[model samples]
Target: MSGLLALLDDVAAIAKVAAASVDDIAAAAAKAGAKAAGVVIDDAAVTPKYVHGFEADRELPIIWRISLGSLKNKLIILLPGLLALDYFAPWVITPLLMLGGAYLCFEGAEKVVHAFAPHADHEIEEDFDTKDPAHLEEEKVAGAIKTDFILSAEIMTIALDTIDSPNFWMQAITLAVVGIFITVAVYGAVALIVKMDDVGLHIAATGRTSGGRALGRGLVLAMPKLMAFLSIVGTAAMLWVGGSIVLHGLEDTHLWAWPYETIKHIAETTAYAMPVAQGFVKWLVAAAIDGVFGLILGVLLIPVATRVIGPLWATMTGKKAGPDGHPG
Candidate 1:
């Protein structure tokens, strides 16, 4: 009986330790996920366009497909790569992060250029849209997934950087949790955003009461505007997050210091100017500066990316296999 009690006590102790670890991971994931909020928002915002013109019936399915792809991106490709980086060459992460930030800046700047360009829709986007419906759906899903991979890389890296785990297993588990949480949050919100008009329509058509119908009508009217708003916010967020990442990376790598220190000084000065709302004011100023920096970098990159990088990529990849090259 005594021996059995001792074994039971040992098991219980192990269980307690396991439970504590789980709790710790959960807490860490949440904190780390918060650190990647800008990327997360951008991911959600960028996704809806993928299913924009699809039939209502196809929207959710397309989102599900992309969600699965995002899952694969985070779990299969990025997670392992991140783990390997942390274990073997931890120093590389900052540079890779800065590279991602540059890409984000480039993307954000391109969108800004496209917004003002004579052609409202880019040539590539137009080509994708003109394809047959089935093909279009496939292409859009593939494009979304590929895009998700980049944003996901940023999110995971940010999350990893924020975590203060003591060892490998804890970091891995925290990252896995963060990946799953962010994916579900991002894609789930996207699914809802894309389908909201249909839901509103259904409600308008079938509501039992006048109030319900009015609300449905309001939703129907509001969705397009909401999507437009999300797009603008998403772009702004991408620039801000990207710029912030690059600044931090440059500072961390000892390549650049003036911008970081300057931004910090400005934020602090602004905080002093408005001590009542110092925290909020400082953050706002800092983010705005970061965004401006990102816009400049992005603008600079636009020519380089289009003139040099695009051709180089096309040459390396052979005929520019479209978005993983799965028939569409």
Candidate 2:
């Protein structure tokens, strides 16, 4: 009896420890995931375009395929690569982060330029017109997965940076949780966003009440505006998060301190001026400054990327460059 009770106590203690570890992993994953919110939003916003012309039934499947690809990217490729880097070359993380941030800035700035100037994507249009539906679907899915890989790399790296644990297993488990959760969240949202109109139509066609039908019609009417709004918000978030990352990287590397310091000083000054909502005011001021800086940096990078690097990359990779000078 005594031996059995001791074993039972040991088992209970191990279970308690396991439960605590699970809680820690959850908490860490949430924190790390939160750090990648801008990327997450951008992922969700960008994914629906891949399913735009597909049949309603195909939308969810395409999203599921992309989600699986995204999961593989995060888990099979990026997670291992990042862990290796963290173990062997931890110092490289900041520079890579800054590079990713710059990419985000470039992407956001390109969108802003497109929004203002409204250039036609003749190549994309021609491809869509010439390609058969099956081929196009494959191409779109492949392209989306490729794009997701880049964004996923950024997300995972950001998460790794946010994780404070020195234990390898803790870091690994946290990253795994972050990767799986984010993949599901992003692609799940994408599926819903794309299918919302169909749902609206179905409701409009079959609703039992006038109010329900009206709600369905409202949803159908609202989807385009909602997409536009998400795009704008995603672009803004990208710039904000990217600029903040770059600024922090610079500060960390002791390369330049003025940009971050200046933003902090201004934010603090504003916060002092308005004590009622000091934290909110401070954060708003800082984010605004970072976004402006991101915009400027991105604009400057546009010419360099398009004219010089884009051509060189195209030549090296034998891939066609898009209007934004990225390989299509």
Candidate 3:
């Protein structure tokens, strides 16, 4: 009887430990996910574009395919690769993260430039003109997956950097949790965003009540504006996050310290001026500074990307170079 009682106590203790571990993992996953918010938001915002012209029935399927691809990119590819890096070549992580940050800056800058100048995307037009719907779908999905791979790599790296666990299994489990949660959250939001119009139309057409119908119509009318808002938000997020990453990386590498320190000093000064909302004011100031820095860096990178790296990539891929040095 005493032995049985001891065994019961032992089991209870184990259960408690397991529960604590689960809680730790959940907290870590949430923190890591939050750290990758910029990439995640951009992922959600960008995904719907791939399904834009597809039949309503096809939209969900396309999103599902892309979601699956994103999951594979994060879990199967990035997770393991990052783990290996953390274990063996940990020093490389910061530089790689900075590279990802630079890419984000370039992408955000490109969007800003495109928005202002609005050049024709002849390649996209050509694809639509040449390909059948099924083939086009395949190509879009492929392109989306390729883009997702880059974003997922950044997400996983950011998550890995955020995780504080020393245990290999804990880190692995937390990363997996972060990846799965993000993939589900992003694609789930995308699914809803893409189908909102249909849902609104259905409600508008079929609702028995006037209020329901009005709500439906409102949703239908709101989707385009919502998408536009999301794009703007995503672009801003990319720049802010990218600039913050680069600044932090520079500090870590001891390559430069003034930019980050200056921002911190200014943020603190602003926060002190608004003691009632110090935290919020500090964060806002810091983000604004980072964003402005990101915009400038991105603008600088655009010419380098278009003129040099684009042509080099075109050459390596054996694709004909466009006038802008991108693959034609």
Candidate 4:
């Protein structure tokens, strides 16, 4: 009986430690996830477009497929890569992060350019209304998954960089939790956002009370504006987060310091000017400065990416396979 009691006590102690560790992991994941909020919001906002023009019945399934792909991208590919980078070449993390940040900036800037120049709804609608629904669905799903992979990579890396774990296992668990939680949160929000119009329609049609019916009608009317607002917000967030990441990376690698320092000092001065709204002022200043930097970098990168990188990618992917067996 005494030996049995000792074994039970040992198990109880182990359980307590495990429980504590779980709490720590959850706390870290939440913190890290918060840091990557911009990318998360952008991911959620962009994903719904994939479901556009699909039959109402098919939207949820399409979102589910994309969500699953996002999960695999984060947990399977990015998680291992992050761990390996942390352990072997910790120095590479900053550069990679900067690269990801640049991508985000480019994405955000492209959206901005599109908004002003306004690509005619020509191609997107054409693709959606394609004769073969099956082929269109496949293409859209593949495109969404590829896009999710890029955003997921950013989210996971941001989470990994933020975590302050003491060991490999803890880091792994924290990142895994972060990845799963973020994926669920993003997709769950997407699902809710996408189906809200249907829900509104149902409520508007079936509600027993007049007030309820009015609310439902209002919801139906409001959804498109809400989606548009979210898109704008998402783009701004991408620029802010992307530019901030690149600035931090530059500081970390000692490539640049004066500009960031100057920004901080200006923010501090601005904070002093608005003592009551100091925190908000500081954040606003920082975000604005970051956004400016992001726009500049993105504009510079646009031409290089279009002219140089695009051609190189086409060549490598054999997208230019020619009849004469020559480069197009």
Candidate 5:
């Protein structure tokens, strides 16, 4: 009887420990997901473009395929690789993260330039290459998946850097949670963005009340502007976050201190000026500074990439630069 009681107590204690571990994982995953927000936002923003011009019925399927691809990218591929890095070469994370940040900066800067100076659209080239809808869909999905892999690599790596778990299994579980959450959040948003027009049209046509119809019509009209806004916001996020990462990485490496320190000082001063919402104001100031720096660096990279890297890549791959001034 005493032995049975002791066994019961032991089981209860184990349950408590398991529950605590679960809570820890949830907390860690949330924190890590938050850290990867900038990349996630860009992922969501970029994915919708892949479904553009597809029939309404086909949009969800494309998003589904891409979401699956993103999951595979994060979970099956990058997860193990990152875990190996964490175990063997933890020092390498900062440099790889900074490399990702530089690429983000370059991408953001290119978009800023393209926004000011619109060129021949990539869609046009894509359209020219594939006349069949099914083939085009396949190509777009494939391209989007490829892009997702890169973005997912960045996201997962950033998340891994943020994870504080000492246990390997705990870290793995948290990363898996982050990966699943990100895939759902990003692609779910994309699905909504892509389907918004159809949804609006349905509501507009089928709504019993005039107000409902009006709301639906408004939604339909607003989608294009919304998409444009998302693109702009995503680009800004990429620049700001990318620049911040690079600065932080440099700071970590004991390379560049002034940029981050100066940015912090400026942000603090700005925060001090605004007594209310001081935290928010400071963060905004820092982000803006980082964004500006990213834009500058990204702009500088554009010419170098185009004049040198693009041509070298083309020569090596036997491919030409795409309409977006990038080697495909």
Candidate 6:
């Protein structure tokens, strides 16, 4: 009986340790997810565009397909790649992050340029429209998954960087949690965004109360504006986050510190004047500066890419130039 009691005590102690480890993992995952917020926001913002122009019934289905692809991208592909990279080629992380950031900047800047130019890429938009619906859906889903892979890579790297886990198991657990949490948060928001119009239309058409109908009308009317707002916000976020990442990477790799430090100092100095609004002002200025830098870098890269990298890529892939005819 005494021996049985001792064994029970040991089991209880083991249970306590397991519980504590779980708590630690949860805490770490939350922190890591928070650290990847910029990338996550961009992910949520970018997804809704792929579902645009689809029939109402098809919208949710498209979103669901993309969401599943996103999960597979993160869990099955990216998770293992991250682990292997960490174990083998850890040195590539920062460079790959910078490359991803550059891509984000390029995308954001291309949108800005198109807005100003207006006639820049009508052919590409027309191509998107001309494709068979089924084929287009497949293409969009594939494109979205590809984009998600880049963002997910950034998020995972950021999460991994933020974790203070000492052991491989702990790091793996935290990353897994972070990946699942972020995928849900991003795709859940995308689903809501995609379905808001349908929900509004249904409510407006069959609501029992006048207020419900009015709310539905408001949702339907507001959705277009909301989508516009999301596009603008997403572009800004991509530039801000991308430029920030590049700046920080440069600083980390010891190439340039003055640009980052200078921006921080100026933002802080500007914010000092506003006691209550200091944090907001600082953040705004920092983002603005980073966005501007991103825009400039992207603009510079465009011609170079077109003249050099684009042709090289086309040649390597044995595809004709101007196949997509898009800036991407």
Question: Which candidate should be chosen as best, given lDDT against the real structure?
Answer: 2
Q: 161-228, model 4: which lDDT tens digit per residue? A: 99888589999999999899989999999999999999999999999999999989999999999999
Reference-based lDDT, residue 2, model 5: 100
Q: Which scores better on lDDT, 5 or 6?
A: 5
Q: What is the TM-score of each candidate against the true structure?
A: 0.93, 0.97, 0.96, 0.93, 0.96, 0.91
Regions of candidate 5 where Cα sits further than 4 Å from its true position: 122-128, 323-325
Superposed model 2: Cα runs more than 4 Å off: 127-130
* Cα lDDT, all candidates: 0.88, 0.91, 0.90, 0.87, 0.90, 0.83
Off by over 4 Å in 3: 127-130, 321-328
Model 4: ten consecutive residues of lowest lDDT: 319-328
TM-score of 3: 0.96
Q: Candidate 1: which stretches are off by over 4 Å? A: 118-122, 129-131, 320-328
Candidate 1 whole-model C-alpha lDDT, 0 to 1: 0.88
Compared with the true structure, model 2 gives a TM-score of 0.97
Clashing pairs in 6: none
Q: How many backbone clashes does every candidate have?
A: 0, 0, 0, 0, 0, 0
* lDDT by residue for model 3 (67-126), tens: 999999988999999999999999999999999998888788778988998778775456
Model 4, residue pairs in steric clash:
none
List clashing residue pairs in candidate 1. none
lDDT of 2 at 232: 94
Of 2 and 5, the candidate ranking higher by TM-score? 2
RMSD for all candidates, in order, please: 2.8, 1.3, 1.5, 3.6, 1.5, 2.4
Q: How high is the lDDT of residue 25 in model 3?
A: 98
- The C-alpha stretches of model 4 lying farther than 4 A from their native spots are 121-129, 320-328
Question: What's the distance in Å from true for residue 67, model 6?
Answer: 1.1
94-128 per-residue lDDT for model 5 (tens digits): 99999999889999999999999987685546533
- Clash pairs for candidate 5: none
Question: What's the residue-level lDDT of 203 in candidate 5?
Answer: 97
lDDT of residue 57 for candidate 6 = 83
